[model samples]
Target: MSERENEDRKIPASDPVIRLTRYAQVPILAGLSVAMVLFLVTFFVDIYDAIQSFEFLDRKKTILLILNLLDMVFIANLVIMVATNTYNTFRLKALVQGDDYIQQGEKAYRRMKHRIVSTIIIISSIHVLSELLEFSQTTPLQVAALLGFHLVLLATYVVTNVFKSSD
Candidate 1:
């Protein structure tokens, strides 16, 4: 390749459109960070509530509270995963050149997808468990719906992993 061509390939952010799109991700990353913090705060507050309540001694109530906290953690982790991947995708390319950027971006994307699906499955399972703990208050239809949703998520995760392995 010509020297100019090589330089052009190395600096994709030189294009105004690419630069603008990358900069646009800044706000999204910021929003994700804020959401993660909120989730963390809520997680801690739930812990505090559990500690302060005599209901914590009750097996069902304690189990439910723990499941709720787990749900919050999974959500916070999802937010962190997205934000980190987004920043690395947009910012890292500008800092690194050549095939390394392409490979890293592709790998990061696949990893993010898997993590997101897995986290969703975990959150769904927690929800189902929590509902089951309060079975008296939960209608049979509600439980069935939650189970169906969890199964769908599980199926999706399996299909995605199958395709990924095939690739």
Candidate 2:
């Protein structure tokens, strides 16, 4: 036994991945929580700015262009959802008490990372496709170069997740 457990202390059942997962959970959540609060604050401020622009009903350009508005909603929702998720993931008091909720939260946290990455990739692809459609003379070479880079990035992330995932 190691020095800390030399006296027959016990640890929860864990494999290398689960052990690393539990170990990795806290700092990641903590960092994400800090980010969440900052983004929520920013979102609120942006909303106020947007509202103020409504006061100028006669203006040519309103609060935000359509794409800008959509981007704000997407980012704000991401920040809020991730923030809540990180909190639930890192809050382990229920886990200590053997609560099912904590386990669910942990699972959700893991799943969310995969889901979020996939969502970003899909949305990015759509955005790029739209831009390509708008451009009258985008070259195959330029498009292929851009797409090749994204494909490499996507493959890398997928491989990393597969290697890291237990199931």
Candidate 3:
């Protein structure tokens, strides 16, 4: 093998720079966990408020509240996915090494990207729905713009998946 290739294969786990980066990821993971908890708390608070106000009697208000809760769920799931994947990529790499690790990592990456996009689309749709529910307060232009943005996101997801499948 070439000298450069041999050097490239050497593990940098002992390197200070590598160690620092790995350590840095700890706080990031912690912050993500905190954020996920906060989202959960917010979700339950919304549910309690809805119950207290007897929003279920009003179909429109109930639907809006449900949509808001769904949006929070999607967002929390996104945050959890990111945190888990980040932990697996960084922390698991040193413990697991092989073709399987590389393959699994790649698959996880693709799935993560797909799910993130899907979550964003769902959240945006919820926002659009909530706005539509309050049509009296929403202008035609605002509705049109929101709808256009949602379509763009949906189209982008479809086109990316098409290309990914082709590959």
Candidate 4:
């Protein structure tokens, strides 16, 4: 190929779009870090409440604490995935092996989505279970709504997996 043709194919070293994309990760990282802190703080608070009141750590309270901790874990996982994936995506080609890095980014995205759906399903199930266990207080309508939400989440997870497998 001619030198000019090769030059045309190359991205400029000072390309604004690439620079901006890379720069954007700074704020994203900062924001997610703050959220991570809050998640951790709240998770600890839930644990403290459960343990400090050990005498009253009945099944309902125990389940709620466990659910809150699980939710926090899922949130933390999501934040980490977003932060790393964002950094990976905007990184300069010179810093990473080209096609392989890009493929890994795609795989990360797929895994993130699967985790998100699974997290929602688990959280939803916890909510439903809590409601069901409170047999005397939970209305039938509330029970139905919670069950429906959980079913939708399950369906979404299944359909997403099927499509991903097909690909």
TM-score ranking from best candidate downward: 1, 3, 4, 2
Tens digit per residue, CA lDDT, model 4, 1-167: 99997766553456678677778778979998998898888888878777887923587767766765776786687678778767666663446554665677677778767777776777677678777877689889989988998898898888879666553
lDDT of 3 by residue, 11-117 (tens): 43367786689779999999888888888888899999889989878998888888898888888888888888898889667775556567878888888898999
In candidate 3, how many Å is residue 86 off? 0.6
CA-lDDT, candidates in order:
0.85, 0.62, 0.85, 0.74
Q: Report the Cα lDDT for residue 43, model 4.
A: 85
| Top candidate when judged by TM-score against the true structure | 1
Output the TM-score of candidate 1. Answer: 0.87
Model 4 weakest 10-residue run by lDDT: 92-101
Candidate 1 residues 1-167, lDDT tens each?
79999888766556688778899999988888787778778888888888887769999898898888888888888888888888888878777777888888888888899899999999999999999989999899999999999999999999889766643
- For model 2, residues 44-154, the per-residue Cα lDDT tens digits are 676677678773363423422333445555665566567667666556533543445556766787777776766566655644564465455667777777687668768
Worst 10 residues of 3 by lDDT: 6-15
Per-residue error at 160 for model 1, in Å? Answer: 1.2
Is candidate 3 or 4 superior in TM-score? Answer: 3
Candidate 1, residue 7: how far the Cα is off, in Å: 4.7
Better of 2 and 3 by TM-score: 3
TM-score of each: 0.87, 0.45, 0.84, 0.76
In model 4, residue pairs whose N, Cα or C atoms come closer than 3 Å (at least 3 residues apart or on different chains), thus clashing, are none
Between the candidate structures 1 and 2, which one is better when assessed by TM-score?
1
